[model samples]
Target: MKIALIAHDKKKEELLDFVSKHKDVFSQHELFATGTTGLRVNERTELPIHRFKSGPLGGDQEIGARIANQELDAVFFFRDPLTAQPHEPDVSALIRLGDVYRIPMATNIGMAQILIHAIRRNEF
Candidate 1:
C-alpha cells in the first residue's frame, strides 16, 4: 500500500510520534509525505518516504494529484482545525479527492489511530 502523510505545522510532532509507534506496521509499505512532515518522520522512523514540497508551496496539490490518479491507498492528515490555514483550498481538495477515490483518510489523531490499528490487524 502507498500511504501519504500530511500534517499542519502545529501537528507535525504528533504525526511523527504516531508514525514512530506504528513503525513496525508502516515499514512494510511505501510512504509519502509533505516536506517538513516527511523530514520529521524520517528522523525517527526507517520508512522510505517520497517527500513533496511544503503544503503551502504546492505539496497538497502534489498529493491531490496522486490521489486523483489512484496512486495512493491511504492518507493520514493531522490538521489543526482550531487554527486558520493559508492553503485551505488545497487541504480541502486533498480530503475531497481521497473520498472521491475511495481511499482511506484520517483527518485527526483519533481517526488515524483507528485506521493504523485496523491496518495492523489486516482489516484494511
Candidate 2:
C-alpha cells in the first residue's frame, strides 16, 4: 500500500507520533509526505518516505496528482482545522480528490488509527 502522510504545522508533531506508534505497519508500505514533515518523520522513525514540496509550496497538489493517477492507496492527513491556513484551497482540493477517487482518507488521529490497523491487516 502507498500512503501519504500529511499534517499542518500545528499538527505535525501529532502526526509524527501517530506514525511512530504504528511504525511496524507503516514500514511495510510505501510512504510519501510533504517536505518538512517527511524530513522530520524520517529523522525520528528512520522510515523511507518519498518527499515532495511543502504543502504551501505545492506538496498538497503533488499528492493530489498522485491520487488522480491512482498512485496512492490511502491518505493520513492530520489537518489543523482550528488554525487559519494559507493554503486552504489546496488542502480542500486534496481532500476533494481523495473523495472523488474513493481513496481512504483519515483527517484526524482517531480515524488514522483505524486506517493504520486496516493497513496492518491488508484490509485496503
Cα lDDT for residue 118, model 1?
90
RMSD of each: 0.8, 0.6
Q: Lowest summed-lDDT stretch of 10 residues in model 1? A: 39-48
lDDT of 2 by residue, 6-67 (tens): 99999999999998999999899899999999999999999999999999999999999999
Q: Candidate 1 has what TM-score?
A: 0.97
Best by lDDT: 2
The superposed Cα distance between candidate 1 and the true structure at residue 65, in angstroms, equals 0.5
Model 2 misplaced regions, further than 4 Å: none
Check candidate 2 and list the clashing pairs: none
> Which residue pairs show collisions in model 1?
none
Deviation of model 2 at 37, angstroms: 0.6
Residue 27 C-alpha lDDT in model 1: 93
lDDT of 1 by residue, 15-110 (tens): 989999899989999999999889888877867899999999999999999999989999999999999999999999988898899999998999
